[model samples]
Target: MRNAVLLPNGFVLTTDNSAGIGEKEADLVHVSDEVVAYFATRVALMEQWAAGAHPISIVLHNFSGNKNWDKYVEGIKKLFGEIAQPCPEITGSTESNMETLQSAIAVTLIGKQKTDSAEKYTWYVYGKPCVGQEVMTESDKIADLKKIWESIKSGLVESVWPVGSTGIAEECKRLGLRCELQGWDIVKSAGPATTVLLGIAKNRIEEAKLHFGKYFEEIN
Candidate 1:
């Protein structure tokens, strides 16, 4: 079953989980627990962010040890700091007594949009995800991300739908959107929501370009 739930108070809550994907695969790099934690955080945050919700709290489910615990918390804080987003009240428990073979974590982001207007919008793909790699490399370009968030915060973006593990085609299908993809393939797994499906009006396209630049890919 899907992990996201919508509340009656115009609030949307989404949860995302991460397993020791890297450790299990020889082809993949063995990512640290901190990186895994950040992946979980980003996955949840992307859902909430796309829905025009301001993240108000974080609830973590940690399976790693004390060392991984601190790194996990740091990853959460680091992103908020980088984006200039207020750090939400964070609280969760670690499964210390039990021992597991691989690291795992699940994070849920709670947020509300605080508005009553119900409006439909034109959709665009924002930032292509090269699996999970681009999320890390592109995130390092702080200015680009900041601009995207600034645009979203200012209402230029009507809504957002972060691409999930199922890939862009599935995500678009989930939202009942048709695809006219270009520059990037549409059926690749985003893996923890490293990219988004952006919603805006046709008239606002130029304005969005100023913020998104190469990150924006229109789907007609």
Candidate 2:
């Protein structure tokens, strides 16, 4: 499915990736392991949470190596660790027989939502994103993501559509929505998907503000 598959038990299933577009050269010598895991895993989990799913497990596809595995896991843990929740079971493999020139990882989340109100939804872009360098340098990034998750849990956010290397402009086109995004660069890469599109309702805007705080942005 292009989107999450709605299951009969009120759950949803989805997957996402955080590949370096095959640009990383020589054993990922230049890329940061922690940054890769953080963005990649967060992207997958966010997609699940967007569908109102409570992530139960994560299956990681690690192409880095044994030496980098701990760092990757550490990054993933940091993502879930923000909410003070135990991370879901994680199991994955590292390439030992061969060496990849670049870093790549695919994160799959298995989750279930207890209930979905099935309300009519409105779309908006969320996050303060920029291209390049700061993907790792930013300190407040994870806390900001936590705020978005908190808003989702607060019933203010119905779902989220992650904006990957494709940037906001392409995602808006894909969703058949006009890119009314203001005060931002909509076509730049949100490296490691530092941003996402939120699905919400008009009535819950206030609640979103209360929970998301500085992380919330509107693009309709």
Candidate 3:
């Protein structure tokens, strides 16, 4: 039996399939900003899970750096100080290897049995007309956002609400969709039979409000 913790950005960390990098100094590595955040968040979440957690294998990924990948794993261990070392692995993809890869990833993260009932949830939000310094235009931003959304959604991740770009919302506003204009925040899952996810940030409350107001309306 094994257990896994998934990050908001749709990455799963586990101990299975730690074979992709050939040989390395450490068992884990960082691949991107999202991944770094995953490691940071995992440290906090694991402490909370310890109260009733069972023995589980773990998998950590994103060690694609050309140098010092092993050092990063040590850093993660030092940072989390709670999670046991996991088997490490690198990710690859081919049309033929898709299912096999996913299976490998799942087994590495959640183990052989728990994945049979993986829980899924969505975290949604909206943002303004502005673009980051590196992100040139709204069109470019839309394409990039869609790519990220597509990858996560392809993995059965759901979007709690329609993602509204400042451009998209402006178009929607013209169409009279009553788009709300406020900052955003997050709402976390509460207990059994619940499946809500939250953002990891200081202003998550305001971030959630940008779309759903104080509470979500019940669908009948």
Candidate 4:
């Protein structure tokens, strides 16, 4: 639940990530445009899916350059492929006229709500927090989006909260739950939602544990 707005049709989820990490002479982190876009889109898509909605359209804000547009879109498409879903309609602009020292991108996903049921659930976390270079080095720890989607579709997951720069404790506060995780790990940022908070039915806890394997951890 990064940023979602309720609309007559559905929830509009919007998320953006800007990094000084890119293949630019002035950039701090030397990464390709594709990698930047992939993570940026990942955050937005995670928010949409977590809210039980399927995206219908996408809006991209590319501050990198015009030359990076296709690569950025390819990065977005790659994420969709990972989830076995088609990329939605995309529209956006590039900052061609001005040169920026850092790589920045924003993504907005418009989705139609798929479920409206209310149920009591126990919360848990899947995946470990990773940021910056750690995101690529510790990619294996990132939560599997496809599996999460399946769990949600199967009704094992009642709701989801993607962890962001604010980390798990802040997200827990927003959900009105006391943070039960110990140490600094509970407060460290989960960049680009590498970790997620899942609300599962009490009876389905075991099933979810099996579904998530070593990545699963109870919040309380």
Best by lDDT: 4
| Per-model CA lDDT versus the true structure | 0.72, 0.71, 0.29, 0.84
Could you tell me the lDDT of residue 108 within candidate 4?
Answer: 82
> Which parts of model 4 are misplaced by more than 4 Å?
182-184
Candidate 4's residue-wise lDDT over 55-144, tens digit each?
899988989888888988998898889888889989989999998877878888888888645888999988899988899999999888
lDDT (Cα, 0-100) at 30 in candidate 3: 17
Where is model 4 poorest over a 10-residue stretch in terms of lDDT? 9-18
Evaluate model 2: give its TM-score.
0.80
On lDDT, who's better, 2 or 3?
A: 2
Candidate 3 residues lying further than 4 Å off, grouped into runs, are 1-55, 61-67, 82-108, 111-181, 185-220
lDDT of 2 by residue, 101-166 (tens): 677777777888766668866777767565455664664542367766777767677767777777
Between candidates 1 and 3, the lDDT winner:
1
Write one digit per residue (lDDT tens) for candidate 1, span 1-220: 1455778887779888876543434324476666777777877877776566778989988876555778888888876876897789899899899866777788888888655336656888876665556656666421244555776767787776777667788888888878778766678776666667878766677888776777677778
Segments of candidate 1 deviating more than 4 angstroms? 1-3, 21-29, 116-120, 132-145
- What's the ranking of the predictions by TM-score, best on top? 4, 1, 2, 3
Cα error of candidate 2 at position 203, Å:
2.4
TM-score of 4: 0.93
Model 3 lDDT per residue over 5-63, tens place? 55443343433222222223332331333323233334222322211122233334433
| Clash list (residue pairs), candidate 4 | none
The C-alpha local distance difference test score for the whole of candidate 3 amounts to 0.29
